[model samples]
Target chain A: MEMIERYIYAVTQKLPQSQREDIGIELRGLIEDMIEERVGDGEVKKKDVEEVLIELGSPREMAIKYRGTKRYLIGPELYDSFLIVLKIVLISMFAGLGIVFVIQIIIDPVEILDHFVGLIVTLVTAIPQVVGWVTLVFALVDYYGGVQTKDLGLDKTWHPSMLSAIPDPRRRIKRSEPIVGIIFYVIVMVFFAFSSNFFGVYVFNDGGFREVVPFLNEAAFSQYMPLVLLLLAIFIVKECLKLISGKWTMKLVGYTVIINLLGMMVVSFLITGDAFWNPEFMSDLVKSGIVTEGSEGYQIGETIWKNSTRIIVILLLVGLVWDTIEGFIKARKK
Target chain B: MNEQEHIDKLMLELRRGTITIGVLSQLSVPQYGYSLVTLLNEKGVQVEPGTLYPLLRRLEKQGLLESLWDTNEARPRKYYKLSKMGNEVYEQLCKEWEGMVASLDHLIHTRKDEEDGND
Candidate 1:
């Protein structure tokens, strides 16, 4: 039993504290009742009790039973949506932690943590705008499709029946995987075609960025075009492939593209004849009247972040978009 | 044509007749697809959800079963129960089943000696 207590505690932690003790009491009582039924009156053996609990499976599963309606697997949400969200959350979390490990190794651990704190500040600062835009798009699409909020499964406390007037197609689309793949391949090609020479339309010649935004010079404004186009391409490819295959090939492609960009950055660093951070390079530039007294390392670091972050976010967002498209396809199937 | 004979052949009769009756009887209390499976399981009578769900739909279309959603849950579960005509039919079936078993057993035993002589 001490093990059972720990198991129960582990599950109960997921519940609200006010209800935790009550739920724990009920669960314990239920377990006792189950045990009694299994190994009856005279005297209950400790080993028998453990065996019974073990047979009942994990604390997570039991907690799910008590906490939820019997909608396992996909639950109440769109099955694909839940899957996509789960994939994105797990992948992003792991990747973020991995990147942090690399950062910690290169810099003082404390400095790395400070950098993390700064990154969080950047994201938290952008959340409202991002969330608002996403919600707007979702709402617009919903209303456009005559999706009654009343019909939405989200409103119900438990999973609701999805009633649609449209008759379900008996036969689903059946095309060869490679043929569908060829179409996707074409879509990606088209995407690259659109984005390729478009960013080069005006090389570093946009002075529209007002001065208020911290890095809002003409050069930054010009950089935005290529970054935004690349982001768009990622999003589009992800969306298209999601429609084609239930998989997120965009991330696979995005990883390759990001690595390519990183390679280019590395090449550019070589061409610039410096690591961009080597002390000798900074000092040489400083002596050449290229650097001023106020040229702190932080600005250079920020510039690198500003440039590389767009690529990382774009790649990851490609994953998210692909997942989103898959969700749509799955939802459409349902 | 009596209770004793009917009791003796009850198993054979139930194997064919009791199944339909049992299925029809449960519908009196509104049950959704999976709940019906649980109910049967708990009662030591196992029915596959695959079979039960489709059967419920067919029975509903045949006018023996009526189904509607219970919207109180997050997922709307479809509930099914017997119609009034279904209840009447079920009661009539139960009586017919009891009478048939009595006759069947009496017929089989009475004709046994005649069959043996022919053999």
Candidate 2:
């Protein structure tokens, strides 16, 4: 009798609150009738009740039958899109972390082995956290019947005419390219912000490989950090847009041209300013016996180093103009 | 599968579709869940208590069956009977079943004649 009560409780608990009381009453009546039929003239016993309950099968299975079907964490309707979003998040996170680790190792060779293990552990832990959060968000969407693919305003609105809007094969930006670019720019921004000394040349001495020549004046670099960060932010946003569209559009090209121009202006301002490069770097080269002071080699090296900024600014401007023209040409192609 | 196993599987599938009509036909007279199972079993259609109870609840929910608790007895029992909608549905289902059975019978008989001619 106690077993029968427990069995009824198990089934009813799984049902909705509104139906539980009615179902419980009905189930108890049915079970008692079954026990009576089996008992016949004999006294009611635990074995008789056990036999009837076993014949009824497990409580969970019975509850499932009453409840209709099994539940899903992420149902089929949203499963594909959930996977796509998860892949994008995970791949970009890992790629960004990997590039940062590689750059850190290059900057500080002593901590190579230590940081490698730390990097792996970080990626391992971060992946599951990212995956779990993404899955939970999608599961909530699925539960609310919000996984309508048509309402997403992309695939559902596709038409034969839309084919003309597709970027030319040769001009199309691969998704991986933009993802890599975004990750690289993020690493560059973090590096320039925190570790200015890491951008110098490494020289092998009696001790070990050490950065003897600092390239950029740390104070001056710090002053321009805000501009550098803004440029990085713009680059990241542009790459993300490219990643989502999976191709170059005229709008994307316009954004690209604007970002490049802004970046060129920042670089030109930093280079043309007298405080950009470390004057000590050239003096350090003379002291290290790599070049003698006032020698032809020293003069040529300094001139090239000073004018290298101008050369780079010119080259970058040319590249930006060419890229803008290419974007327009691709947008106009059949 | 061997012959008996194959037949058992086929019979199970067939019985699944027929169980609703079988229970509905007998429920014209008031019967509790266990009583209905016993009645159907005695008539040679073995209805499991687990399957029958859930099905009765489902039918009651669908408005095809009406149930009441008979608490006058020493033990209370919930008795189910066919509703007016249930009776009409049952009659229609029976007519469809008869038409299907007649057509199948004729098809089988004609197949037997063709086999006899070939022999």
- Go through the candidates in order and give each one's C-alpha lDDT: 0.51, 0.78
Tens digit of per-residue lDDT, candidate 2, span A1-334: 6788899999999999998987788788878878878888789999999988999999998888787753778776567656666666666676667766876775577899988987888777877876776677667656654444434544766777755545568668776776677667656654665557657666656765544567778877788888877777676656655664566677778777887778778877877788877878788877766789999999997998778756766887787678677766875565
- The per-prediction tally of clashing pairs is 10, 0
Candidate 1 matches the true fold with a TM-score of 0.28
Q: Number of clashes in model 1? A: 10
TM-score of 2: 0.58
Q: Chain B TM-score for each model?
A: 0.68, 0.92
**TM per prediction:** 0.28, 0.58
For candidate 1, lDDT tens digit of each residue in A14-74? Answer: 6657758755654554455556666777688888778766865677765554454333322
Best by lDDT: 2
lDDT of 1 by residue, B2-119 (tens): 9988886885566434556667878888986666766777887755443454456557767988878666764456778899988898899989988998999999987997899899
- Off-target runs (Cα >4 Å) in candidate 1 are A14-19, A33-45, A70-334, B1-119
Among all windows of 10 consecutive residues in model 1 chain B, the one with the lowest summed lDDT is: B46-55
